[model samples]
Target chain A: MNESAISIKDAALDYPRKKKGVGLLREFITGRFKKIPRKDRWFRALNGINLEVKRGEVVGIMGPNGSGKSTLLRVIAGIYAPDEGSVEVEGRITLLAGIGTGFNQDLTGRENIKLTGSIFGFDSNSISDMEEGIIDFSGIREFIDDPIRTYSAGMRARLGFAIISNLEPDILLLDEVMSVGDYEFRKKSRARIDELVQGDATVVIVSHSKSILQSMCDKVYGIHNGEIVTDGEPDSAFEFYESEKE
Target chain B: MGVSENKVLRRDGKLPFLSAPVKIMQNLYNYRQLLKHFIGRDLKVRYHNSILGYGWSVLEPLALTVTFYILFAILSDSEDPYRPLTILLGILAWSLFAKTFSNGTTCIQRNSSLIQRVYFPREIFLFSKSGYNMFHFILSLLVIIPLLINYELMPTQQLILLPIALIMILMLGTGLAFFTSILQTKARDVEHIVTIGLRISFYLSPVFYPLEMITGGRIPEQYAEAYLIANPMATYITMIRSAFTGAPLDIPTMNLVITFATTIAIFWIGSIYFMRKERKAVKFI
Candidate 1:
């Protein structure tokens, strides 16, 4: 698993976006099938995305909206199938891309922890053991027995983040790291990310904040129009990103 | 980690993305947990809105029994001697089937947030809905305490068979629920169609009247037996209803055979179909 690590070759994503060229009714009827005709189904959300991240290397992705960043993240996580190529993840992978999104609002925090852990592939006994660690980290002990719907956004995010961290994946994927929680909780998340990267874990962070890009990531890819327009050292990627803004 | 970067793309035709068999095996275990989580959430949430918390589990069913007791006693001109026990089991059993059927059909769509984002075995949602309703259905039957005694519908030693019969009914409800839930996931219109189907199923089953009384023994014996075989509940209710009537149930061998076969077949087919489509349930949502 260590030598094999994670690699992607020629991976691509395409999503159909409706163009307003035709009459609404005629377009609507055809839209029910393949839509936009066979020639135009592809928006080419990610164009031949290729990369190799060795064990324990921290990889960061910096991009604007619709730059195919999250699409690439999902591809690596195996949530979406690649149309053009394949991804080989040697070890177990976990994506911390969502916060409490899989949590059931009707379930208590304790129940949700077990249910969510199982949903992501852990067994029941492990969930019970991990429950304490999850609860301790989130600092929401008193309300752990309460339903998640009662929790505020910060509280829910803490729980979601805590569960993802408990997974301890060899390949850890993060999206919009700065946007996780309130400023106070975001500080906690940053510390956790730093601690996780210190281990043998490989991390890929997707963020638009230049400060984070400069401080955390050694390697970065500046992407636009669904392609990696620049790939190199962090400073170099940012230099290309800045020039693109003009 | 993978090699042959330049020469390995030799396939003439593309295959389906995920292996069908492996996915089914994985989903079988996955759906069990999903069933637990979804049902747990529903059971907890249902009482959260009520001041009674969970006593509504007992209170709601008891109230329904009382209302029916009064209505059936006064409204019907020609009430059968066993009418009290008849309405009691009939209404409770029908409610269980109806609730499980109607709600299970809509479960995959209802939990789009949970299903759409993550990959999970889809039948978990269906099983959860059925599991939650079964909890309520069981709690509701406890209301039969006074209702049974006041009407002198209290049973003989044959009443000990009540627990076994109830378990069978639960299995039947689960089988029907699992089958219908998977069907409805593919077709949005199936939800509406199922609601109507449940109502018709209630009439078709020997819920309200005894099968013997419904047709009168005038119908040929083989046809009546076949009808009973086709309807598991017809046999189910006929035997169990007499638990209240305090009479010996001449259980039919053929009826039991049909009940056993239907239960196993539905579970097997329902699980396979549900597993196949389970991955895509979230995608559609």
Candidate 2:
């Protein structure tokens, strides 16, 4: 067995812009009534991108906005299917993006924790066991019983990070998660992530921060125009990305 | 790297139609906990901060029943004993269908935020929204138990049919929902179309009035049976009413058979359509 945590072979994904209501309706009416032909518009988000992560490696992906970073992550998470090639992921996985990735605003903080935990494939007993730790880490004791809509953005992000960081998934996909918190919380989050990586959890993170990538990732891949342009150690990849940006 | 190793997860485009039904069931079972959470979220959000809370679930149908009773009171002074009970039964049965359909159609769009964040069975969104409505339907039945007792409508062997009728409504509502929710994901106009269609369906079916009004005299004799078979809601309401009040079923036996078959067909077809559409639909969202 190769013991690979993630694998992508020549993956490509595109989205259709002209297949929605107005476009479809216009085409239908034209074809049936007006006898006209219509063309469809397409946007290719990921193009022939191939990468793999071994069982215990921490890899960071960096790219400019709209360069398909999130799209690639989504593809690997099985949330979006690649238009070409294939993606294979082994082990339990969770994608943690911005604050409140799966929290319901109307639910109490406690309720939201249970809900998000279940959605992440945690059993009820596991969620119950982690309840006190999550609440304590979030430090939102007063509002833990209040609806999530009442919490501040910082509070919500704190709660979200706390719960996600506690989960012991074999694979973790993080999308710019460290950008949300204050300095102290970010430090705590970094420590928690370091602990997970130390415990042999495979991690893939996407971030715009070169410093963050250089600090945490064993290998870094720089993406440009929907393809990986640089792959190597953190310093070399960051250097290549910086020169390309200039 | 081993090229032929078994991958734990793979996203091949478009599953085979033969596997769609089984796949949907598998996803439902795997995501049952998420479905339960969503149901709880729905019920809590709906009743939170309301003065009456869960009482509104019972009161809404009861109030509608009273309004229709008053309106129908003017139509004829026939002195039929089961009129009010039948009317209540019809309203309750039809609302279950209507609420589930309306909520299920828009549920995917409503959970667009969650869709982008996680990958579970998308149908869980549809089921959870309808599931709470089903819960409300069950709770409302409690209110009617007193009414059933007050009217001395004791249980008969036919009472076994009550659960069957309710299950039929759930299947039919969910089937229509799966179809509409997929369409609404691509086109917002489907929502408006569904709303208008449902309203017209309410009028065409025997929700506010008795089935006798149509079968007895209004329409020509030959078309009456066709009309009942054409509108499954009317047949469903009649069955539920017959089960509860022990009234003779005005609906033909063949009509019941056709309705059941049609409900199953729609559910199967809807599952097929939804699974195919769901894979491509996430990108649009």
Candidate 3:
């Protein structure tokens, strides 16, 4: 019970920069036959990051564009293996990034719920059990049966948020999803997230919105140039973040 | 407290070679529901708007069979009565391999959005593509039933080879898919090369002809066994055709054994290659 929900130690991830035309082709062919020394090719996305999230904690990650905030979440979610160091997580974890992640435009909103649910490893019976709740929460009843391509951006985001929130993983990773939808929808989602956080779910929210982080996060980490520049209470973290911005 | 129960990921952590397959099977079993959803989505998205729906699955191979049948009839003096049946079987089996390979290679890139945001077994995408094509192959096989009835061919014990041939083809196709899907993410040219390779392999394979054309005299008798061992698809298609036409499985025992062993080797090697490159491949995509 005392164990942290998520822990990382000195994790680093690097992505290769883009190469055009002949150089890429040569690299590709050589890469197949031999391990061409690629030390110079990689751009470090996460640099020696160390983080720990206690159970029932609400953590916020604030960073500028290209500052490795998303990559850090992905590593915790197990979508990317760090190039160095280690990561450990207890309990089930789910990362919901962007609106309508993996929605088939041709499928109706009702069907896409089941599809996305299964993508999270939920069985049919459980997904079916949660179907009505998701639909009710999204409040897109009339358009639920219509293909998602016909739904507006806000409607798609609403449906997407509804499905993930209902699943209720032990650890939730949110990346800029709260920035979408209308003001009313945002308030509703914020309340729903509060309920989960209060019920002892570990939450990690990555956003550029300073006020949202300050109000919601128990602790905020400000990342700059793929490294944490500040890790403290929201006020101090924001102070460092604002100074860096100027 | 119970660190053993927690999931730990390290850069150098890898399951031993002997246990890798067991671990993969366990992972696949746990995510069976996701695999089912993926396969269902593939089927729906493919035939959703088509007028004929699943009927097109049968029609495509049938049309190809007729075209090949006519061309062969004009090109040669052979009056083989089971020509159409064998061609259809070959086309169906070959399409399963071709579609699985070509689609499997690009599956990672095609599903890059889901791959980036979600964390399920990436192998599910490749299997779903194979399963979708396998479903079409089975549907198309139903077209051969009437041909069998017309020819007065009864279901023989040889029909048992059908599933055996299927597993071999699936193993080879899915195996190659596992390897290439990762590579294709890094180099887009892999797909183009696979396309041209499949086109040439169609003629090299016994899709529109019988194995007799090679074993009889076209290929030197010394290299006949070597040919079968080199191209496992030739043996697989021949097994499928013989199962339907009740033609004797003329493949030698040693040749069959070697081809089956080679097929398994390809599957194993491809899987290992995929596992090693998978983490790196995702970054490139």
What are the clash counts of all predictions, listed in order? 0, 0, 0
Against the true chain A, what TM-score does chain A of candidate 2 give? 0.86
Q: Which stretches of candidate 3 lie over 4 Å from their true place?
A: A19-27, A30-37, B1-12, B15-18, B47-51
- Which rank order by lDDT, best down to worst? 3, 2, 1
If scored against the real structure, what TM-score would every candidate get?
Answer: 0.72, 0.92, 0.92
DockQ of each: 0.17, 0.43, 0.45
Docking model 1 quality class: incorrect
In model 2, which runs have C-alpha deviations exceeding 4 angstroms?
A18-40, A231-236, B1-7, B47-51, B77-79
Which candidate do you rate higher for TM-score, 1 or 3? Answer: 3
Q: Give the better candidate number (1 or 2) by DockQ.
A: 2
- For A1-246, candidate 1 gives per-residue lDDT tens digits of 246466777777655443223324334456666454655644777887778788888888987777888877766766555667776665556777767677777778888887777666666676788889999988899999998889998899888898888867677888887456677777887898888877788788888888876777768988888787776578878887788778
Best by TM-score: 3
Better of 1 and 3 by lDDT: 3
What digit string (tens of lDDT, one per residue) describes model 2 on residues A1-246? 667889999988877655444435445456467643332446777888889899999999987787888888888888887878889888777777775656777889999888888877777888899899999988888889998888888998899889888867778888885655688888888888778867778899898888778778989988877888776578777887788788
Fnat, 2 decimals, each candidate: 0.11, 0.47, 0.46
For B144-172, candidate 3 gives per-residue lDDT tens digits of 88999989998788899899999889889
